[model samples]
Target: MQHEAKAARTVKEDRTDYLTEERYGHTAAHATMALTGTEWGVTTWNTRPRSVGRVTVCASNGPFAFQESISPVEARLIAQALLMAADDAEKAIDAAYVQDEVTA
Candidate 1:
C-alpha cells in the first residue's frame, strides 16, 4: 500500500441568492406600534444535498435587532403579504389625499 498527498478541497458549498442593499427590508408601522425606520438585511443561501434554501432577516441599524431563519417558501409568502399590505397602504394614502383636496 502507498500513501499520496492530495490538495485540500471544499466539501460543502453555499450559494448565496440575495446579498444586496436593495433586497433589504424595512420596518413597518402597526396598529399599536410606530415605525422605527429600521433597515433589515435579507440574506438567502442554498446548500447542496443538505437542506432547502434558507432566508435570514436581520436589522441593519438598531439596538433591537432580530434574525430569523426560514425556508424559501415561507419567505415568498412573507414577500407576497408585504406587497399586498403596501398596496393597501398606498390606496389609503391616495384616498386621504383626495379627501384633503376636496376639503381644501
Candidate 2:
C-alpha cells in the first residue's frame, strides 16, 4: 500500500535528518558512555535524516575520562572520540593486557 511505502521512506529519512529530542537523549547517552570508555557498541537513532549521532571513545587505561569547563562542541567530540580511541586503540598497545582480562 502507498501508506506502507511512505512509512518506510520516513524511516529511511530519519537516519540523516536532525534527530528529535528523544533521539538527542540517546545520542547524548551513547556519546557520554563511549567517551567514558565502556565499550565499542555504538548505535544509531532517528533513522530519518541519517544522524551518526556520536562516537564514544574511551581512554587507554579504561578508567573513564573527565573534563572540566568545556566550551565548543568540537572539544566535546574530541574528548569523546579520544577517550574511545584510546580504549579501542589499546589492543595495539597491550595485547596481553586485554587477553589477561576476561568479560562475563
Candidate 3:
C-alpha cells in the first residue's frame, strides 16, 4: 500500500498527461517531493503521431519517476526543514499567547 499510493500520486498526471513531451521524450525532467509523506512512485511515457512526418512537442512529459528509497542525507534535510517549520509554528503560538495576555 505504501508503494502503491506513492506511485499513483508522484507523477503529476494532469488532463493532458498523455500528450506531454515527457511522454515522447522532449522536455527536461524533474520531480516534486512526495506530498503525502511518501516519496515512492514511477512516471510513465508514450509517443504518438499527429500527422505524417510531423512532430509535436508535449509539455506533459515526465516525473513518471519517484524516489524509491530515501537517502539518509535527504531524510536528514527533510527532517531539518520540518523542524525549522515547526519552530516557526511554535513562535507563532507564542505570539498568540502574548497577544492574549495583552488583551487580558
Candidate 4:
C-alpha cells in the first residue's frame, strides 16, 4: 500500500466559507465543504477500492461521528437518508423559531 497527501484549499466570501481538497491521480479523490452561518454543505469523491468514508456532525456542546465502507448502492441509500434527515431537522428548527416568535 502507498500513502499520498491530498491538496486542499479554502476560500471565504462575506459570511460564507468553502474548503476543497483533491488527490488527483489514478486513485483520484476529492472533498469539498462549505459553511454559511450555522449551515453546511459537503461533497466527496472516493475512487479507491474498499475506501471508507466518515462523517461527523457537531454542535456547540459536542460532536457525533459515523464511518463506514459500503457498496456503491448502499452509499446512495445512506446519502439519501442523510439528506432527508437534514431536511427534517431544518423544518423542526424553523417551527421552533416560529413558536419562539409567537411566545415572545
Candidate 5:
C-alpha cells in the first residue's frame, strides 16, 4: 500500500492547531556513545486540548537520518522506564565502588 505524505508541520503549528491551553516545552541533545559524531535531540512539548493535557516527544538523529514522534502516554511510560534503568545503573556503580574499597 502506498502511503500518502502529509505536509510537514512545525511544533508551533501543531500546538496552535491542536492545543488550546498553556504550553510548555523542553529540548536537549546528547552525544551517542556507540557512534562518533552522532547527536540525538529530545524535545518534549506540553499540549492541552479542552483540559486534557498531552505531551509530544520528538527525537532526531542527524547522522543516522532518523526521526520519530511519540505520543504523550508512550513518552511518559518510556520516561518512567528510563528513570528506573538509571536507578539500576547507579546502584550497580555504587556496588562496584564498594567492592573496590573492600578489595583495597
Candidate 6:
C-alpha cells in the first residue's frame, strides 16, 4: 500500500511537470508567431496554486483579451472549435486566392 501511494505521487508530479512544460512551450511559440501577425495566442496557467487553470486568449496586435477558467472537458471543446475555425479560415483564403488567379 505504501509503495502504491508513492507511485501515485510520482505519477501526479510527472503529470504536473508535463503540463508546465507544455504551457511554457505554447507561450514561447505564441511570442514568435505574434510577430508575423498571423496567430492569436492562448496561454494556460494555474489560477489557484495546483487546483485551477485559466486559459487566456488574446490578440497579437491589439489589447483584446478573453480569459476563462476551464475544466478538461471545456478545454477539449475549445480546442475543437478553434480547429474548425482555422479550417474555415484556410478555405476562405484559398478561395480568394483562386479567384484572384482567375481574374489576373
By lDDT, the best candidate is 1
Candidate 1 structure quality by residue, lDDT tens digits, 51-98: 446766665445776778788789899999999999999999999999
User: What would the per-residue lDDT of candidate 6 be over residues 1-104, giving only the tens digit for each residue?
Assistant: 11110101112321222111124223222322324543344444444465446444444445544445566677688889989999999999999999999999
Backbone clash pairs for candidate 3 read: 20-58, 20-60, 20-61, 21-58, 21-59, 22-61, 23-61, 42-64, 43-64, 43-65
- Candidate 3 matches the true fold with a TM-score of 0.35
Q: Between candidates 4 and 6, name the one with more favorable lDDT.
A: 6
Better of 1 and 3 by lDDT: 1
- Once fitted onto the true fold, the runs of candidate 4 whose alpha carbons sit more than 4 angstroms away are 1-67
Question: Which digits, one per residue and each the tens of the lDDT, describe model 4 over residues 1-104?
Answer: 23333333332331111222333444222232224222222323334333334222222211533333355576578779989999999999999999999999
Candidate 6 residue spans exceeding 4 A from truth: 1-66
RMSD of each: 15.5, 13.2, 14.7, 12.5, 12.3, 11.6
Candidate 2: how many backbone clashes?
Answer: 19
Model 3: per-residue Cα lDDT at residue 104:
100
Tens digits of per-residue lDDT for model 5, 36-77: 434434444445443234444333355346655666687689
**Going through the candidates in order, what is the number of backbone clashes in each?**
0, 19, 10, 0, 0, 0
The parts of candidate 5 lying over 4 Å away from their true place are 1-37, 44-62
**Order the candidates by lDDT, highest first — what do you get?**
1, 5, 6, 4, 3, 2
TM-score (all chains, Cα) for each model: 0.61, 0.23, 0.35, 0.41, 0.50, 0.47
| Cα error, candidate 5, residue 53 (Å) | 7.8
Please report the candidate that would top TM-score against the real structure.
Answer: 1
Greater-TM-score candidate between 3 and 6: 6
Question: Which consecutive 10 residues in model 6 have the weakest lDDT in total?
Answer: 1-10
- TM-score for candidate 1: 0.61
